[model samples]
Target: MSETAVPLPAPVFDPARVRSAVEERLTTFLDAKAQLAAAQGFPAEVTDVLQDLILGDGKRIRPVLCVAGWRAAGGCGDEGPVLRVAASLEMFHAFALVHDDVMDRSATRRGRPSAHEAIAARHVGRPDAARLGMDAAVLLGDLALAWSDELFHAARLGPDQLAAATAVLDGMRTELMYGQYLDLLATGRPSADVDAALRIARFKSAKYTVERPLQLGAVLAGADVGVRTALSAFGLPLGEAFQLRDDLLGAFGDPSETGKPAAEDLREGKHTALLARALRRATGTERDLLTGYSQGVPPGPAEVVRIRAVLEGTGARAEVEVMIEERRRQALRVLEEAGLPPAAGAILRAAASTLIGPAR
Candidate 1:
């Protein structure tokens, strides 16, 4: 087995181009909405926050997937409605992030203070900074959730297609919530069984991240069940590989590149595959070092380096890299078998390769 044997499709469509197109469309929609809100005498602060959240830095992968899926499923329509649906996904994602940061007590998002903390920082002298910030962010998140539903309702799909797409969205939300609970449970407990941890990662990270977004697009485009199933076969493994790579970066990636503290996962005592493997394979003092260095308010940088050394020494890093390669290969196999539109599949294949293939 080669370390990475996944054959990617040619780049039929550039992801950066697709991302730019989607961002422009979303900005237009948001600008129109902001103007309408201003005409209604909405608070400027509210409108500003809404606009910033919508136009903030993001990869815009979900909506792009929605549009791509629509194209792949033989849908012939203006891209506008599909873009709205995709933008709606972005709003829902904002809701998730706001709440997630609050739960994780994270200080930053996309290289800025998190929504709650940002607002809190503005009123540092106020006695209720934390409360005010949390309240504002909660309402903001709620607004985004409501907007997502409204946008979905306004999409161009027929009644049956609309119902099917909405159902998928609901399922995605439910599964993500459950995955979060599983994550909370796994922390500060006995380390999850390796296989079980992977299962949780798939449901929590992979499905919501990739499979659901693609399914939404396919569903809205009225794809048959066979097509939808085949896309899942491709999306699930690719999504899992994506998260696995994220786990590696969380521990070992340069902070300048990744925009988060390195070894933050270790500080959080995250039971990722890397950590689980280290726990299982380390011997004597290395195992003791890992166990001892796993938790605290802020793990020291030297300890993080030590943890990395332990992971490398135990072959866990190599194992994880190999697993990522295998998952990518499996995803490509599914894509080849799915008989999707060659051009669309080619684009998706390239996106997946860029997402999960070895770093350049």
Candidate 2:
């Protein structure tokens, strides 16, 4: 199925408007942190990096989802507490990204030096550039992780709501770590089952990216069993589609648009659904090339092009696109069935559009 075949609603909240609100909230949160750091005698550069990571240019999708989920659960559209929760999610995300970049040995993120690399670059005279960078980045990630709980605790949630949100946060962190390990493990093996690979992708990337954020918001709003169940039903499939979209971007998205190198996932030997499907469909020389191409050092541009050709020739790219569309449709169906408040559901529907909707 073509991506255009999916019917997406007009987004309920303006993307620009939502983004502005998120930015304002993030600024407030970061400014307060900067003051706290200043009082503690933190170096200016350290505080700057922290603020940059927090207030950097991101889609702000997680926090938006949290707010949307809360609204869907009949919570008021108050920005104060929601912003704190959002900051917590964002902090946690920074923690994940810093560590993920370290594990992948990635040099750039969002079109700039990654946190660890940035820190390392500042210490040119240091005896251990890589080690120092890694260590500094790890420490920064830990700070973000710790701040996540502090923000969560500071939110004006009741005890029960706070407990529930904490549980979701804990599960998300643990599951994501496990998922990352599974991804690393898959690279060593010659072949992977497509279904199993999809499961891992869902757990590792999708839940953390989409499901947990929505669940966190819903729980904060004290959503009932039916409401929470509906949100999960809507979130899981949509989350999977979100990851699938990312997988496509990793392989084929423009480096300029995605703010990362094209085929970076392949370079990291990520065993995504697209790669797994391609491997399944490849034969003879194509299979040999793929097996050899993914191992050892990263493939150069010529090799990456060759790998793309194999994927295209085998129709794996098209097949994965079809799967992406299917998952999107399933998510929409769940939302339609959930019978959420029209306004809230509309916002969620819009959020889904923004998430998986095709690029211009």
Number of the predicted model whose TM-score against the real structure is largest: 2
Q: Positional deviation of 192 in candidate 2, in angstroms?
A: 3.9
State each model's CA lDDT, in order. 0.77, 0.80
User: Which number leads on lDDT?
Assistant: 2
Instruction: Please identify model 1 stretches exceeding 4 Å from their true place.
Output: 1-12, 32-47, 190-192, 283-296, 358-360
- TM-score of each predicted structure versus truth: 0.88, 0.90
List the pairs of residues colliding in candidate 2: none
Candidate 1 structure lDDT: 0.77
* TM-score of model number 1: 0.88
User: Each model's number of backbone clashes?
Assistant: 0, 0
The residue pairs that clash in candidate 1, if any, are: none
lDDT of 2 by residue, 15-96 (tens): 5665677677667767887888789988666667767766777888888888778777876646577668877888788888
